[model samples]
Target: MHRVIISGIGAEIPEPVITNEELVASFNSWVDTENARRADTGEPLLQKSDSDFIVHASGVKSRHVIEREGILDPTRMSPRIPARPDDALSLEAEFGIASARKALAHAGVDGSDIDLVICSASHHQRPYPAIAIEMQEALGTKGAGFDMGLGCSSAAAALHVAVNLVRAGAHKRVLVSTPEIITGHLNFRDRQTHFIFGDASVAMVVEGLAQGEKRPGRFEVLDTRTWTQMSNNIRTNLGYYTRTAQEDPYMINLEGNLIKQVGNKVFKEVTVAGQKFIVEFLAEHGLTPGGIRRFWLHQANARMNAMILKLSFGHDVDHDRAPMVLE
Candidate 1:
């Protein structure tokens, strides 16, 4: 089996940063007005949120959103990205192509060298045309392309698959791009998770290293493990066929289509599950937690990562040990 190495990496972040202060102010203003309206109708008032509370809860001080003006608007707290023509590249594909181009350049390889293109992300722009295929066409690559979704772990899962394909000699080079347009699915009116997600695309070039290849500076994929369990703690209730009888069958609304998460349940369950997986994964490979130099964990929450590391390592790890990028 050939060894797989990560030759290069690149990222594409949308412009216009939305600070937590700005979001909280707009959200609270909307909440106050909504509450006043509800009071007139004898309905329960909506709760107000604070910036400090948001930061402490999720450790997200700000985020990069695709539509800055519309999301921050008190009236319409949603992204207003216009739809593109069928022939034009979708927004997700545009970002994916930008990141993939940078990754290919960094790898010192052209698009022709990529044997496969994998578009793994939290969500896709459309259902008919696979984004991976569109990316392949845009890059002028002559290989197969596909899409995969694993929620928040989509990129890691895709990396695992790319590594295996390269090791098995199925492909000499693979381009994995994760373009997360998460804000499009978020209900900004909902205070629980409005401040969680951001917009960005990350790309990586994975290539097979033949015997005696002297790539001294490249990083090798030693091992990877993934596990899945049935749970509804985090989910979105939306699909092409799902619809209310009273509403149009094809019309998608934000009511049930947006992301819904049980914060407490997810925090507890994922902390335990993540720690167990890391411990077992390292142990299986004859490695220890302390021996690992750096831990680039998922950019979720600061407190959650801290707790998971503490439980797994039997000690408290500092920021240097586990760096966070959610902010």
Candidate 2:
């Protein structure tokens, strides 16, 4: 059996920053307009959103976006990314390549060194051709590549796959990249979730180590576990097969595909499942909560993460021990 280790990591964040104040203002204006329209139809008015309320609810003070102009626009409250030509590189592939290059550079290796590439994310730019292959071409890697989508757990799932590939001797070096442009899927006009997502790309380099071969400062891959249960609390209903009976079924609409979640259900389900996984993982490895130095959780919600950490560790973990990037 071989050991797998993380050799390098890289991240890329889009330049545009949308602060909570800006987001709240835009959402509130939309809400006011919506409420006025609803009043005309005898429908209930929508509640106005506030920056303070957003921060308190999600602990997200700001988020980075790939397109700032369109998202901030009062009318078009969504990302304004145009479709690319077939010959052009896809946005997700471009971001993935950039991050992979940095990871390769950090590891002092070129594209030729990688034996596999895995592009994983919550959202993908296209439904075909696989962004992983596109990134492999852009990075000039000879290795094979594929794409994986596992919702918010995609990155962890990709890491698990890479480590297993290395441990199985099927690959020597693997690059796992997550180019998440989640803002595109957000219904910016909806106050409940408009402030929750951002655009960014992250990449990790995993390599197998043989006996007597050591790479200093590399983090070992201990073990990974994933669980799946049937739940519609968090889901998106967007795909080619989906159809609406409306006349303008092909018209662009956010209501059908945008992320929708039952907040309370998701909070409870995720926390319980996450806590169980942690307890089992640590126990199987003969480790305790105090043995871990840092816990970098998914950057989803501050409250959810804090509670999950608290439940798993049997106490409240300080900010330093469990840092968050959701903000």
Q: Would you estimate the TM-scores of all the predictions? A: 0.97, 0.96
After best superposition, candidate 1 residue 312: deviation in angstroms?
1.2
* Candidate 1 segments whose C-alpha is farther than 4 A from its true place: 244-246
Predicted structure 2: lDDT: 0.87
Give the poorly placed runs of model 2, Cα more than 4 Å off: 244-249
lDDT of each: 0.89, 0.87
lDDT of 1 by residue, 9-79 (tens): 99998897999999998899899889989999999888888889888888999999888888988999888
lDDT over C-alpha atoms for residue 192 of model 2: 71
Candidates in order: C-alpha RMSD to true structure: 1.2, 1.4
Q: What is the lDDT of residue 139 in candidate 2?
A: 86
Model 2 worst lDDT window (10 residues): 238-247
